[model samples]
Target: MDSLLSVCDIKEDVSYIIDLAIKIKAGEIEDMPLEGKTLAMIFQKSSTRTRVSFDVGMYQLGGRAIFLSSNDLQMGRGEPISDTAKVLSRFVDGIMIRAIEHEDVVELAKYSNVPVISGLTNLEHPCQALADMLTIKEHFGSFKGKKICFVGDGNNVCNSLLLIAPLLGMDMSVACPEGYEPDENILKISKNFAKDNNTEITISSDINIALDNVDIVYTDVWVSMGDEAEKAKRLKDLKPYQVNKELMDIANDDAIFMHCLPAVRGQEVSADVIDGPQSVIYDEAENRLHAQKAILYHYLK
Candidate 1:
């Protein structure tokens, strides 16, 4: 638990860490283990939940969080990530990094003496997936045997979900356009984990089959932060997969809709679906704070 590089990095003992989160959320735990500690947050891209949640979550635990934009640090001026990681490690107890290049975060972890958390990267969004699982557990009371389907581009979010969902004994499926499937390595690793856990994980391009009997219907923007050039074609290709009433109708009657927000109204998901009674996007977003507080407590302790 020294650093959170990926969901696969969490060993079996991690269940106790999640239990700590549940206790902290219920106010059963009073004193903060990270009291007087400081977290150095490095961001190469702009954010909403990741920024605010980490800052506030740290403060609530009697710790300080310092936000450093690429422009605010010497690294903005072409400094090597290794040098930056070495320098920052001396000053902070932990480093949380959100960047496009996954390698930079790896370099940070390699050089830093303290923990390095991956806030987000083009290849994975582990913390987001963690919060998402937390939200799912809150709604369903258990992840075991629950079917969760993700529709749209199998991007970083999907990649991480594909990795972790099965590890918790949940069935996961992804529906994406041809050739847009999740990372091969992540999928391969997840398949192995699923085999060991006796869980099922599948992927397909057919949205209907993906949604059938799913307990959770999830989606993300057709075009992500770095895919502006494909926006038009994506809008057209993804139109059929939109989580509208019709698509949702194919899922379990009580199936909940989830989106890691900053959702495009008519792109990845429809406005009606996100605002619908089944939508828990806001709850998913809010849990970012609680789940991450749990992660911080686990590593810091």
Candidate 2:
């Protein structure tokens, strides 16, 4: 694959990458395949998992990571993404960008000579999707006959899950309020991908119908970065969709709970459920390191 700007970009190799991540996490990857590589991390958005995981993962793979915030890069000073992509490609083996605009991530990958990974974007979180898949595989030992329900705002993390889940042989459902559904084009593409992969996709406003008996019941914060302005409205709209104990009870008995972190306890998910025994948020977060290591190996090594 040239780059991973979206999960769909690496659809055919999704299973391979997940397998590599599993092996890497289990200490099965003996040799450091990325001994001489360097990854430049450009962050227009602040993060905890994306930043630390990529940084540490590179080190463990015998490579290194460079952190570049918006202030550190010329792009913050109005330099075009094309110029930044071209220049950074000459200095680093790969680029990982967490940006406000999905278009910017696409533009960077288009211009860069090296592979560009979408660390996170307003439209999709491809790396996070990889980690989530890795976590699910670890919990259940396989993807067969599994269903995942994304409960809340259909934002970046949910969008990535929509695209990747069905591709990996898992059915996906999203329960969101009206005017808060996933992107139309992405939903269409994911549905098409589902058909070919023999899985299913569904969306609903009724949380009960959507969450019913799913293997994974996942949620993300109602308000996201750059969304502080609409926080009150978002909280009001998504309050009913929160993954509380009652909501969790609607899922399968063995269902695991997940959140792409920086989660608000009483907003998208309750403290009880997120801190409960079934929650795998920490394991999911940890898998970010292994998954991105596999991504690094695939593109840079």
Candidate 3:
């Protein structure tokens, strides 16, 4: 793949990368696949996991990563994305962008000679979904017939999961407030994929129904980075969907709780539940390193 702007770009390679991440995490593979290469990490949005994971991942692969925040690049001002992409392609083996606009990543990929990875965007977060799949596979043994339920605003992370779960023969349910549902285009695409894979995709406002009998209970913050102004409204709308102990009780006894973190303990999830035994948030966070390493290896190698 020339770029990983969406899960669709890595569909055939997902399992391979997830398996590779497992091996990397276990230290079974030590060769530096990206040795002597350099990765340009452009961040239009601030990050904790995405920043640390890719930087450290490149180091572990015996390469270098340059951290370029919005303020660090000419693109921060008014430089055209195409010009920046072309310039960076000459210097770096690969480029990874965490930006607010999905189109920015698309434009970078379109213009760059090197492979481009979408670290995150408003529409989808492919890398996070890859790590999530790895974490789920680690917990469950396989993806076939597994069930995952997402509770909260159906945002970028939700969109990525909707694309991936059906492709891997796993069923997924998304529960959100009426007006806060996932992108309609993504839902339609996921539905088609589910039909072909013989998996189910359901969207509902009833959180209880979504959690019932699922193997994984997942959630994300109600207000994402660009949605800070809507915080109060989102908090009010999403309060009922919080992944507290009572909600967790509704899921299967062995169901794992997951969040793409920087979680608001009292908002998206309760402090007790996030810190609880069933929560795999930390492991999930760490897998970001391994999963991204695998992705970089795929593009850079």
Candidate 1 wrongly placed segments (more than 4 Å): 11-14
lDDT at 47, model 1: 97
Which model scores highest in TM-score? 2
lDDT of 2 at 213: 66
The runs of at least 3 residues in candidate 3 whose Cα sits more than 4 Å from the true structure, single-residue gaps closed, are none
Q: List the residue pairs that clash in candidate 3.
A: none
Clashing pairs in 1: none
Model 3, total clashes = 0
lDDT against the true structure, per candidate, is 0.87, 0.93, 0.93
Tens digits of per-residue lDDT, candidate 1, 1-301, equal 2688788777464456556667788888777778989999999989999999999999999899999999999998998888998898889889999998988888889888889999999999988988888889889998876999999889899988988788788889998888789999989998998898899889999887788779999998887788899878888887788888888899999999999888988767778989999999998998889888988887765
lDDT of 1 at 108: 81
Query: Which lDDT tens digits does candidate 2 get at residues 169-195?
Result: 899999999999999989999999999
Clashing pairs in 2: none
Better of 1 and 3 by TM-score: 3
